[model samples]
Target chain A: MRSVSQKATPDASRRSETARRAILTAALDLVGRVGYAKLTIEGIATAAGVGKQTIYRWWPSKGSILFDAFLSLTTDQQDGALPDTGDLAADLKLVLRATVDELQDPGFDLPMRALHTEIVHDPVLAADYATRLDEPMRELKRDRLRAAQRAGQMSEDVDLDVAVDLLFGPILNRWVQRTGPLTHEYVDLVVDTALRGLKP
Target chain B: MRSVSQKATPDASRRSETARRAILTAALDLVGRVGYAKLTIEGIATAAGVGKQTIYRWWPSKGSILFDAFLSLTTDQQDGALPDTGDLAADLKLVLRATVDELQDPGFDLPMRALHTEIVHDPVLAADYATRLDEPMRELKRDRLRAAQRAGQMSEDVDLDVAVDLLFGPILNRWVQRTGPLTHEYVDLVVDTALRGLKP
Candidate 1:
């Protein structure tokens, strides 16, 4: 049986975790509805049923709140990292398929588009997003490509940075521009074409 | 020697043309400075030294005004189209290099980014820009790719739509994300990689 102190501590931690999630959810919902320009920490606090100080303690600004909310929502996928089955094509195809699913979700799409627009116009937000969101994903891709090179599966001469761009650019472009359906077949083709170009 | 009627007609036309250019320049300038959300048609007219009626007569809304302004600034490149030297690699490289130059220009980049942010937020603006700006460019790329396929330089199995995305996506990604310097060598690599993957 757990001691009273131990049970009490975990109960408090769980309650805090729940409050944090509610705050993040409220932030995403408000941003999607009212946009990032109009979103406020007070509004998010009210929506989350938390004291404004609770949010202020965790995040610096409304942008940081939204960024954290976004990061939390995507934490599972990012934490999973890209699969390394020793087959570059299959691994990339799996990751891209998952990405397409994420991008297609209305929950993720609207708030993300709002954040993306803000990032484009605000230099500070752009740098913050790049450091927190983009850099991790990029590093994961580079690591996979480097592993592929070491295994003699991909050309050592390949520029991994450019290779990363070539592999992911089409999907990002389509998502941003709303050019077409981001279907599974499309990612398969993208992976196939890119891998063909990147092979040793 | 010009006839009297021809001389007067061209003089008036030139005057009208000058006014049009001034309006566009003013629109771009204001959007760059104040952003699309804060910008108004009245502000543009005042900056251009024209009446608000003149701007309203030409463009239906502030977004339309900025869109027209952006189109006017890019008209030269659109008119020139992609070079059809019957060499796919060289032609794409030339066009992308020109694109890099245009994107790098502060005159083009700031206002374009402003308009782009607006488009991402507004669905109607997205559709409007797609029809006016994106489709024409896509059609041009498709035509070039088709010609390449006919010339046996590309695989007939290539999906033209996907091919267009793959070819232009990296450049667009770099431009939108400000991820890295879009240089001549970068475009060369993009063209080479895409073409290698695309060949029969």
Candidate 2:
């Protein structure tokens, strides 16, 4: 929430950072407890112990607040890169299994599902999600695939976009639809099966 | 509304059939117009010109009503079987392309998104969806894959459930997350890539 002004001293910036973290943390906690449909700015403000004006100054809506909260959580785990151990299958399996673990964690599950519920019906939020979360995460995955291509592990003509989907889609769809169990073995199979078609 | 008793007669069955159709049709229309969140039994009753008791008697809740309405729509199109033309690629492409068309259709899109939105947050509704809709659809798709396996078009070691997810998951994920455009070309690539890994 720090602005580009000379008046933003180190003390002020630290205060701003503390408040920002509080607000985002509160947003996630409140959403998890009350659910997204019932989440409100007033509730978030009350939970965060901050004025509604502070939240308003930063995020325009509850969706945006939740988005930032989820994004912050992801950023903490990933460094915006998939592992490239020169073994595509092993690397992908490692990353996806971590994802499986995170999804299964109760703390992460509620807020994440809440964000998805908001994103599904709201186009503006969905677009924001794509630009901010989905695309960047996809790009990191694509970077790994591109490395595979360069290593001659994958074909030149393969569409990385489609490949990313084939690799990640099943896990995602299963999680969202509750169509199957999310387990390390499932992701391992996904990686192995998808790699066959992706490889040169 | 017909009970299995001596009082149940041909005239009563005919009237029940007409009312059932009206209720299902009205549920879809009202959800499309006002969305699932704002939709109510009272509104559906008013729209269908039936008593609220009639809808309550037939379906336990709004979610159940929507489920039946959607099932009715899908039943009108697919006969619980994916076309088995022996050419696995051709058969899947044909079915997936029709799905692409349906998802793009506004009438189908709205109610479908609504059902998904409801399913994400509500475990009870999600369970009903999996039992009543998702499982039946997946079974039909699996049957086609099984046929491919028997014909030696796909490997015997291939897990049909994983294969089904690989083929359909990408498109479903893209649609649900709004991560990418749904197109014949996209599904074609998905089928091709997934088939490479699947084929013996």
Worst 10 residues of 2 chain B by lDDT: B1-10
lDDT of 2 at B160: 83
lDDT of 2 by residue, A7-92 (tens): 66877789889999999999988887788888999999999999999999998998888888888998888866888989999999
lDDT of 1 at A170: 93
Instruction: Please tell me the interface RMSD, in Å, for model 1.
Output: 1.3
Q: In model 2, which regions exceed 4 Å deviation?
A: A1-8, B1-12
DockQ of each: 0.62, 0.72
For model 2, how does the per-residue alpha-carbon lDDT over B66-160 read when each residue is reduced to its tens digit? 88998999988987788997899999999898998998898888888877887777777778888989998999898899988899999998878
RMSD of candidates 1 onward, in order: 3.2, 3.7
Model 2 chain A weakest lDDT span, ten residues long: A1-10
The residue pairs in collision within model 2 are none
